[model samples]
Target chain A: MKGLSKDRLWAIIVLLPSIILLGIFVYGFIGRTVYVSLTDWGNDPAQAMALHPVIKFVGLDNYKELFSGFLQSRFRQELVSTIFFTVFFILGCLGAGLGLALILDRNPKGEGLWRTIFLFPMSLSFIVTGTIWRWMLQPQGGLNMAPTVLGGQPATFGWMSSTDAIWKFDWNKLPLLTASVVGLVLAWVAFGAFRRAERTRAVVAAICAALLLGWALFVGPNLHLLAAPELHGFNLALIGIIIAAVWQMSGYTMALYLAGLRGIPEELREAAQVDGATQTQMYRSVIFPLLAPISLSAMIILGHISLKIFDLVYAMSGPDNTFTSVPALNMYLTSFRQNQFAMGAAIGTILLILVAFVIVPYLSSQFRTQEGHA
Target chain B: MTARAERLTPGRIGMYLILLLAALFFLVPVYLLFATALKSPDAINLATSWHWPAQLNWGSFRDAWDKIGGNLGNSLFLAVVSTLFAAVLGSLNGYALSKWKFRGANTLFALMLFGMFIPYQAVLIPLFQFIKSLGLYGSIWGLILAHMVYGLPITTLIFRNFYADVPDALVEAATIDGAGFWQIYQQVIFPISIPGFVVVIIWEFTQVWNEFLFAATLTNTNSQPVTYALSQLAGGQAVSWNLPMAGAILAALPTLLVYILLGRYFVRGLLAGSVKG
Candidate 1:
C-alpha cells in the first residue's frame, strides 16, 4: 500500500507540469483575449502603443459594429464567403477522396506509387502549395496556356483576381434565413429519430422545430440586421482558393476512408457475395453505410480547417485583396498591422466561438464514447 | 479464394486510366514548379510558361538559397528542439494518464484534447503579450516555446492512445517486482515507446517545420523560419517567378524528404492524429 501511494505521488509529479502549462497557456490566455475584446484599447494611435495605456470598457460594441456597422461590410462579406467556402470545400474533398479511395480499393497496380503522388501535397506547407498554385492559376498565364499545346486558344478565366460573385442575397434577410435553416435541420433530425424509434429524442426535436419555425414565421422578418439591402454572396475568386485547398486536403480524407475500408471484415464481403449482391449494390448498401462515421469525422475536421483558414489565402492573394480575404488574415492586419487591438481581439473571440460551436460537441461525443470503451 | 491468373478486362483498364489521370492532376503543379524554376528570367514568358526550359538555370536555386538559407537553419533548430522537448513531455504525460489510472485522469485528458482544435488566433493576442513580458518576443526561442506548448495536446494524445494499447499486465508485473512509476516506465514502458516516439517526432517535426502563422507573427526578419521567408519572397508583386518557385522547393525539401523516407510511419501518424481513441 505504501508503494502504491508513492507511485500515485509520482504520477502526479509527472502530470503536474503539463497540467499547469495547459491551464495557463490554453485556458488563461483565452480568458485574457476575451477580456481584451471587451475593452477599447486601440482607439487612439499614440496611446495604443504606449507602455501602459488607458483602456475603457466597451461591452459588445465591437461585435455589434462588426455585424451591422456600415463601414464593416468587409467582415460581413467575409463571413458569407467563409460559409460558402466551407460548404463547397467539404463537398469537393468528400467527392474526390471517396472517388480515389474507392478506386484504390480495387487492388490496382502501383497502388503505393499512386497514393504517394496523391498524398505528397498533404506533406508540404500551405506556403509552398499556394506559391506553386498561384503561378499555375495566373489568369494570363499557366493554365490558360495549357490548351495551346493542343492547338486550341488560351482560356481567359480569371482564376484569382476575379471580382464577380454569385448567389447574392440581402443582408436584411439573414435572421429569417438562419432561423429557417435551424428549423429545417431540427425537423430532419426529428424525422430520423422517429424513424429509429427513439421516442424522447424525436419528441424533443419535434417541439424545438415547431417552436423555431413558428417564431421565425412570426418574428424574424422584423429583426433586420441591416437598415437597407446589402448584397453578399459567394465570390468567384474563392474558386481558386477552394480548388487549391481541396487539392491539399482531399488526400487526408482519402487516407481516413481507406483505413475505414480496410477495417471492414472480409467475411462481410463474402456474405454479400453469397447473397448475390452485385459490385455496385455491394458498395452502395454495405461499404458506404459502414463509412458514414468516417465521413462525418472528416467533415468536422475539414469544416473547422476551412473556417479558420489563413496562410493559403495570404500567400495566394496578399492581405489587401478584399475578394479573397478571410477573418484570420483580417485579424492579423487589424491588430498587428493597424494596431486596432480591441477590434482584433473581438474578431479572434468570434472565430473562437465559431470553432467551439463545431468542436465542443464533437470532442464531447468522442470522449464520451472513449469513456464507454474504457 | 482461388489463385486464378489475372485478366486484362475493360473495367480494369478504365480503373487504371482514371488512376493515371488523377496522378497527372496531382503531379501537374510539381512539373510546373520544376519547369518554371529551371527557366531563365528572360526565357520566362506567359505564352510558353508550360513548356520545358530550353536551358537549365541552376542559378535560381543558388539565388534562393543565398536569401533563405539562414532561415532554413533557424527552422531546423526550432523544429528539432521543440520536437524533442514535446516528445519527452508527451511520453511522461501518456505514462501517467494511461498506466497510473488516477481519479480524474480521463477527464483531464479530454480537456487537454480540446486544446488541440482551437484556432490559435483566439489566443494570439494574450500569448504575444505574455511572451513579450517574459522578454522572449522576436527571438527563435520564443517561437520554439510556443510550438512546444501548443504541440503538447496532439503529441500527448498520440502517446496516450499508443500506450493504452500496451497490456496493463506488463505494467502491473513491473509494479509487483518492486517498480515505482518511473521505474515501470523506464523498464517496461520506455522500451516499447520507440514506435510512439517515432510517430510523435515525425508529426511534430513536420508541423513545426511547415508552420507559418506563429513564425510570421512572432519572429523578426533575423529570426524568421523558412516558411515565413518563402512567403515574403513569394508575396512580393514585381519579382521574377523563378525565385519564389525555387524558394518554395527549398522551403519544402526537408519535410518532403522526411515524408519520402518515412512515409509509412508518416501515414501512421496522420491516421493516429485524426482517428481518436
Candidate 2:
C-alpha cells in the first residue's frame, strides 16, 4: 500500500510541471486572449502602446465592426477569401492525393522513390515553398516563359498579383447562403441515415434540416450581413496561392490515403476479383468507399490549415497585399504592427472559435475511440 | 515483381506517364530554385529564366551565407535545445499518463490535445504579454520557451501513445521486483524508449527548425531563425532573385537533410502527431 502510494506521489510529482506549464500557456492564455478581445484597448492610438494602457469593456463591438463596419470591409473580404480558399484547398488536395494514392496502389515500380519525390515538399517550411514558388510564378519570368521553350508565344497570365475576381456574391446574402448550405448538408445526412435505416439519426437530422431549410427559405432573405451589397468573390490571385498550398499539402493526404489503402485486406480485393468485378467497378464500389473516412479527416485537417493560413501568404504576397490576406495575417499586422491589441485579440479569438468548430467534435470522437480501445 | 511485370499494358503506360508528370510538377520549383541560384545577377532574365545557367555562380550562396549565417546558428541552437527539453518533458509526461493512469488522466490528456489544434493566433496576444513580462521577448530564449511550452501537447501525446504499446507486463514484472515508478522507468521503460525519443526529437527538431511565426514574432534581428531571414531576403523589393533562392535552399537544408536521412521515423512521427490514435 505504501509503495503504491509512493509511486502515485512520484507520478503526480513528475506530471506537475507539464500540467502547470500547459495550464498557463494554453488554457490560461486563451482565457486572457478572450478577455482582451472584449476590451477597448486599442481605439486610442496614444494609449494603445502604453505600458499601462487604460482600457474599458467593449463587448462584441470589435466583432460587429469586423462583420459590418464600413471601414472594415477588408476583414469581411478576408473572411470570404478564407472560405473560398478552404473549399478549394481541400478539394485540390483531396483530388490530387487520391489520384496519386490510387496510382501508387497499383504497386508501381520504385514506389518508395516516387513517394519520396512527392513528399519531400512536406518537409520544407511553407516559407521556403512560398519563396521558391513566388519566383516560379513571376508573371514575366518563370512559368509564363515556359511556353516559349515549346515555340509558343509567351503567356501573359498574372499569377499572384492579379486583381480580378470571379463568382462574385453580395455580402448582404451571406446569412441566407450559409443557412442554405447547412440545410443542404443536413438534408444529405438525413437521407443517408434514412437509407441506412438509422431511424433516430434520420429523424433528428430530418427535423434539423427541415427547420434550417424553412428558416433559410422563409426568413433568411430578410436578413443581411451588411447594409449594402458589398461584393466578395474568389480572387484570381488565390489560384496561385492555392496551387502552392496544394503542392505542399497534397502529399500529406496522399500519405494518409496510402496508409488507408494498405490497411484494407488483400482478401477483399481477391474476393472481388473472383466475383469477376472489373477494375473500375471494384475500385468504385470497394476501395473508394473504404477511403471515405480518410478523405473526411484529410478535409478537416486541410480545412483548418487553410482557415488559419498566414506564413505562406505572408511569404508569397506579403502582409500588405489585401488580395491574399487571411485573418491570421491581419491579426499580426493589426496587433503587433499597428499596436491594436484589442482588435488583434478579437480576430485571434474568432480564429480560435472557427478552429474549435472543426476540431472539438473531431477530438471528442477520437477520445471516444481511444476509450473504446482502452 | 512477376505479377507487376505481367500487368504491363496501355493502362500501365498511362499510369507511369501520370506519375512522371506529377513528379515533374513537384520537381519544377526545386529545379527553378537551383537554376536561379546558380545564375549570375546579370544573367538572370525573363526570356531565359527557364534555361540552365551558362556558368555556375556559387557567389549567390556565399552572399546568402554572409547575410543569414547568424540566424542559422540561432536556429541550430533553438532547435537542438528546445527539442531536447521538450523530448525529456514529453517522456516524463507520457510515462505518468500511460503507466500511472490516475483519476482524470485521460480527461487531462484530452484537454492537452486540444492545445495542439488551436490556431496559435488565439494565444498569440496573451502569450506575447506573458513572454514580455518575463523579459524574454525579442530573444532566442523567448522563442525557445515558447516552443517548449507549445510543443508539449504533440510531444506528450506521441510519447504517451508510444509508451501505451510498451506492454504492461514488462512494467508489472519490474514492479514485482520492488521497483518503484522512477526505478521501473529507468530500468525498463527508459531503455526501451529510444525509438520514442528518436521520433519525438526528430519531430520537434524539424518543427522548431522550420517554424516561422514564433520565430518571426518573438525574436529580434540578432535572434531570428533562418526562416525569418529567408522571408526578409525574399520579401525585399527589387532584389536579384538569386539571393532569395540561395537563401531558401540554405534555410531548407537542415530539415531536408533530416527528411532524407531519417525519413522512416520522420513519417512515423508525422502520422503519430496527426491525432488519429
Candidate 3:
C-alpha cells in the first residue's frame, strides 16, 4: 500500500499539467463547439432565424439546412463538391503513387535523388502550393504560355476566375469541372511514390506511359473545353490539378507500398519461381494479395484527408475564385465570413462524422490486430 | 520466352523512361514556381512560359522579405516556443500515464486520444469564439494554444511509445535511492530519452511552421506568422507573382532545412509514430 501510494502520487504529479492543457484546450473546446452548434450563436441570428431567441432544438435542423435549396445556402453544393473531391482525389493519388513507386523500385542509380525530388512538394505547405499553382493556372501563367511558346495556339482561359469557370450548368451552379480540376491538382501535389511489382513494372510502365502521353496529347486537349467552353481551345486546369494531386500523393502511397513490400517474405517469391510460376503469376498471386491491408489503410487515410482538405484547395483556388469553395471553405465562410457560426459548425460536425466513418473503424481494427500480434 | 524472359532487356528502358517522364511531370509545378520567382513580373506576364529568366531578379526576394516582416522571425519564434512547450508537457504526461497506472490513467489517456480524430475544422468556429471571449483572439498565444492541441497528440504518442520500452526496474531503483519523481525523471529518464526528444521537437516544429489554417484564421498583422503573412502578400489583386514566389521560397526554407537536416530521423520518427500509435 505504501509503494502503491508513492506511484499514485507520482502519476498525479506528471499527469495533471498535460491533462489540464489538452482537456481544456482540446476535448473541452470540442464540447463547447458542439454546444455552440446547437444554439443561435451567430452575429445576428435573430435576423436570419425564423424565431426570436432562436435556439433551434431542431436537433439536426442545421444539418437539414445543408439540403436546403436556397441560393444563399451553398450547403448541398459544398457537400457534393466535397464528395467529388474526396473520391477522385483518393483514387488519383493512390493510383499515381503506386505507379511512381513501381518505377523507382527498379533499383535505379539515382533513386535517392528521385525520391527527394518527388518528396519536395510534400514538405511545402498547401499555402505555398496554392499560391504558386494559382499563378501557374492563370491564362498567361506557365500552363497556357508554355504551349504557345512551343508553337501550339495560346490557351486564352483562366481556370479559376468566375467569368472563365469550367462549368456551364446553371441550375445547381454545381461547378463539376471546377471542383474536379481543383481536386486533381491537389492530388498531383500530394502523391509522389507510385510503385508495384518490379517484374511487371516494365509492362505496366509501357501501358501507363502510352495512356498518359496519349491523354496529354489527345484526350487532355478535348477535356480543356470543360474549363472554359467559351474559349476556342480546351482548358487544361482540371487535368493539371488532378495530375498535381496524383503526383504529390503517389509518394505517400508508394511509401505504404514499400513498407508492405518489405513485409513480403522473400521465400514465397522464390518458392513461386521454383514452382514454375510465371513472373506475372508470382506478382498477381503473392505480392498484390499481401499488399491488400496496406492498400486499404492507405486508401482510408487518403480518403479522409481528401475530404477535409482545405489548405490545398484554398491555396490553389484563392479565396475570390468560385472553384476554391470546397466544403471546408464553405464551412469557414458560413461561420466566420458570413457570420453563420451555427450553420458552419453544423457542416463541420457532419464533416467530422464522415471523416470518422472513413478512418476510425479501419484504424481501430488495424491497431487492435497489431496489438494482438504484439 | 519462359525463363530468360524475366531477365532485363530493352524492355527495361521502358520502365526507366516511364519513371523519368513521371518524374518530369511531378517536377513541372515546382519548376514553374522557381522559374516564375526568378523572372521579372514582366517576364512572368509574358505570353509564353519562360523556362529561364531573362534576368534573375534577386530584388523580388528582398520585397517578399519586407512584405512578410522582412524575415521569418515571427514564424520561427512561434514554432520554437510552441514546439518546446508541447514536447516538455507531453513527455511528462506520457511518462506518468505509462508508468503510474493511476485510478483514472486510462481515462486521461483516452481523452487525449479523442482529440486526435476530431477534425480541426470542427472546433474551429467555437475555438475562435472562445479565444475572442478570453481576449486572446488574434494573438500569438492564441495560435500557440491552438497548435499545442495538434502538437500534444503527436508528442504524447511518441513519448508514450518510447517510455513504454524503457525498463521499469530502473525506475524502481531510482525510487529506492531517495529520488523523488522529478529528480528521477530529470536525472535518469531524460538523458536516455534524448533521441526521442529530438524526434518530437523536430516533428512539432515542422508541423507548427507549415500550418496555414490556424495561422491565417487566428492572427492578423502585428502578430501574423510567416505562413499567414505569405498568404496576405499573395492574396491581393494584381499579385506580384515573383515576390510571392520569393516569399514562399524563404518561408518554406526553415521547414525544408529541418526536414533535410533530420531526414533520417524524420522518416524514422514518422514510421515509428504511425506504426506504434
Candidate 4:
C-alpha cells in the first residue's frame, strides 16, 4: 500500500468522499434503520411524544406483533395484497408489453412515433399517472359514463373502493392454501426436471413438494382470526391501482422486449417460415422461447417495482383507503402518521426481505451468467 | 420467407389497427390530464366529466400554480442542485473505479450497487431521524442530500460503464503529460462523458423530481417538493378534480418535457440503467 504511485494515491483521495458519503448515508443509514427497527423507539409515540420517545431494544417483538398479534392483521393482509399485486402487475406488463413489442418488431410505418408514444408514459411521475387514472376510474363517471353517453346505463362498479376480495377464506386456511400452491409449482418443477433426467434436481423438487403437502395435510398452523373467519383474497379495490401501475410500466417492458425481438437473428424466423410454419406458430415455437431471458429480466424488474409500490397506490387510493393499502403505504402511515416506528420498520424489513427474495437470486444469477459468457 | 415486399393484407390492417388501439389506450390518460386541467370547475360536472370544456380555461392552471408554485420552485431547486452534485460525484467515482483501478475497486463498486436495490422504506425511519439530527429535518437542502445519497448508485454505475469504454491509453497518455488524477479527468475523461452526464441528469432529475416518499417525510409544508404538494391536492378532503389535475400536469411538466424533447436519450438512459445497473 505504501509503495502505490502518486496518481493512484490521488485516485484514492478523489474517491474518498463518495466512499464516505455512500458508506454513511446509504449503507450506514440502512444499518442504523435495521438497528432502530429492533428497538421500541415509538410503539405509541404519537404526536408530541415522538420528539423524546421511548427507545428500547425489544428484539423481534415488532415482527412478532405484526405476524401474529391480533390487531396487526392489517400487516398480513397487506403482505397478501402485495403478493397478488406483484403477480398481476408483472403479468399485465409482460402481456401488454410483449404484444406491443411484437407489433413494433414488424417495422411498420410510424414505428418511431408509435414506439415513443408507447413508452412515453414511463416518463411521467407516478403521482401524475395516479391522478389521471383516479379521475378516469371514478365510480360514477369517467369510464363508467362513456356507456351512458351512448344511451346505456353507467357501470356501478367501485373500481378502487370495492371492499370485496375474491377467493377470500378463513385466515386459518391460509397456510393450507399457500402450501397447496407451493406444492403444485414444486410438482411442476419436479416433473420438468424428471423429464429432462436431472435426477438430483428432480428428487430435490419432489422432496420440497412432499414437505409442503405434508405441512398442508398435517403441520400447518391455524391462525386465530380477529373475526371468526378472517378472509384474505384478491381485493378488487386494488384493481384500479394495479391498472395504473401496469399502464405506467408496460412501456418499459415493451422497450425491453422490442430490443430483444430485434436482436433475434432474422434467419431463425426465416428458417421457420421456410419450414412452412405459420406466423403464430413461428412466434409460439421459436420466437417466444428465445425471449425467455427478456421475460425473466422483465419479471424481476417489475417484481421489485410492484413490491415497493407506494406513490402510485397513495396517489390513486389516498391514505384513508385501507382496502387498497400496500405494504409500503402501510409502512409509511405506520411510521410517519401513526408513530409506530418499530412496527413500520418491521413492515419495511419484511418488504425488504420479500424483494430480496426475488432480486438477490436474480442479480447473482445474472452476474454468474455474465461471468460464464465472458 | 417471401421477398422483401409486405403486402397490405387484412392481417396487416389488423396489426395496424391493434397498434393504433394500443396507442389510443396509452394516449387516453395524457389526453384526460390536459383536458381536465384546462376545464372550468363548472364544466367538470358529472355528465360532462369526459367532455372537452365548453371554453378553454387557463384559470385552473393559474389556481393550481398559486397553490403549489412555491413547492414547484423547491422541487426545481432541489432536483437541479442534487442532480448536479450527484453527477459530479458519480463522474469522479466512476472515473476512479473504471480507470484508476486499485485493489478492491470492483468489490467497492459491487457494494455500492447494492444500495440501488435497498427499498427506501427500509431506511426511511432512520433517515428521518438522521435528517433531524443534522438540522435538515424540514429543509429542501435535506431533500437534496437525500436524493444525492440515493442517486449515487445509478449515476456512479452509468458513468462507470461509460468510462470503461474510454481506452486506457488516453489516460496513460495524460499521465505521460504530467497530469494529476483530477487534471486527467478534466482533459481526457470529462470531454467524452457528456452523453453519460445527460443520461444521469435526466435519470436523477426525473427520479428526484417525481419522488414522493422522502419529500413527504422530510419536509414541512413550506419546504415540500411539488410531488408532495400534488399528492396533497388529491389526498385533501375535498377532491377538486380540475385543480388537482392542473397541479398534476404542472408538477409533471419538467419530466414530461424531458421525455417529449429528449425521449430517445431518456429511453436509452433507462435501458442502459437497467441492464448495467
Q: Model 1, DockQ value?
A: 0.73
What DockQ does model 2 achieve?
Answer: 0.74
CAPRI level of candidate 2 = medium
Candidate order, lDDT descending: 2, 1, 4, 3
> For candidate 3, lDDT tens digit of each residue in B202-262?
8788778888878867886777888777777777767768888888889888877876777
Candidate 1 lDDT, A225-337, residue by residue in tens: 87888999999999999999999999988988988998999999999999999999999999999999999999999989898899999899888989988898888888888
- Compared with the true structure, what per-residue lDDT tens digits does model 2 show for residues A217-323? 99999887777889999899999999999999898898989989999999999999999999999999999999998888888888788888899999999889898
TM-score for the first chain in candidate 1 comes to 0.97
Between the candidate structures 2 and 3, which one is better when assessed by TM-score?
2
What is the per-residue lDDT of model 4 for residues A24-83, given as tens digits with 9 covering 90 to 100? 876787787778779877775552155566578989888878766788778778888998
Interface RMSD of candidate 3, in Å, is 3.4
lDDT of 1 by residue, B90-183 (tens): 9999888888877777789878877878888888988888888888899999999999998999889889999999998998888789888888
Error of 4 at A338 (Å): 1.3
Better of 1 and 3 by lDDT: 1
| Model 3 CA deviation exceeding 4 Å by range | A1-5, A43-59, A154-158, A161-242, A370-374, B1-8, B99-110, B165-184, B272-277
TM-score of 3: 0.81
lDDT per model vs. reference: 0.90, 0.90, 0.69, 0.85
When sorted by TM-score, best at the front, the candidate numbers are 1, 2, 4, 3
